[model samples]
Target: MRHFLTALLVMILTAHIAIAQSQPVLNLELANKIADAAQEKATSENWNVVITILDQGGNLILLKKMDGTQIGSIEVAQLKAKTAFEFKRPTKVFEDMIKGGAVHLNTMPITAVEGGLPIFKDEHIIGAIGISGVTSVQDGIIAEAALKAVSLN
Candidate 1:
């Protein structure tokens, strides 16, 4: 009976370790790296923007606003990041749905615009990034470039 109990304990520990390993972690270092990349891209284009990063649990990890960027973009950036984190998908999905006549999505608690993208590691979402300033398409481009720069796609 002692040996069986010991075996069961080992099995439980192994399972716990496996579950922890399968979950992706997002830390400040990674979030800053992503934000830096986004800033660089926006700067290169001479565009001022606001960037927001959120952890998987919908917690704000980082927020950056370039000089001369509109103040309103701050909230928009946060909303986009929150939407992405909450939905575990890019905000563009909602925009696409709306374009396809899913206007009801606008009434939902989502930004429903481009520029929000989920950050993935090993096919699992770790966090999300959102940018606002220029056009929606341009914001999306900046977010994509940031993800690619960090190799977090």
Candidate 2:
């Protein structure tokens, strides 16, 4: 009877753990809203920047380039967003790591740029946003504002 009770308890715990975790998905409406928020922030700051939004799987959801933004920034922005989504962390984390002598991280398919941020809902990452064409810190600021618009940090 004791062994049966212990096994039953373990099974119950396993089921609870599985039910407690779920992956959130990024939909088109949310992606557009996030991009729009980022663009608005950049405009308010008088910054011509490019914004890219990606789903948690690293698929591009939306891309926006403000007037006068550098053409090269479009690709950079996408790559940054992809890196953030796939790695499940802000691009700044990787940037700081590289700056702190983790130079080997450069060999991976990730960007050590500061403009990318992951978007989370219910403590789960649903997507990411990346901004470019300004100072790295400023770009991050714009992305962060976008994440805030969606109530994600």
What lDDT score belongs to each candidate, Candidate 1 first?
A: 0.91, 0.87
TM-score of each: 0.86, 0.82
For candidate 2, report its TM-score: 0.82
Q: What is the lDDT of residue 64 in candidate 2?
A: 79
Can you write out model 1's per-residue Cα lDDT over 73-139, one digit (the tens) per residue?
A: 9999999988888888999999999999999887898999999998878777888899999999999
**Model 1 scores what on Cα lDDT?**
0.91
Angstrom error at residue 86, model 2: 1.0
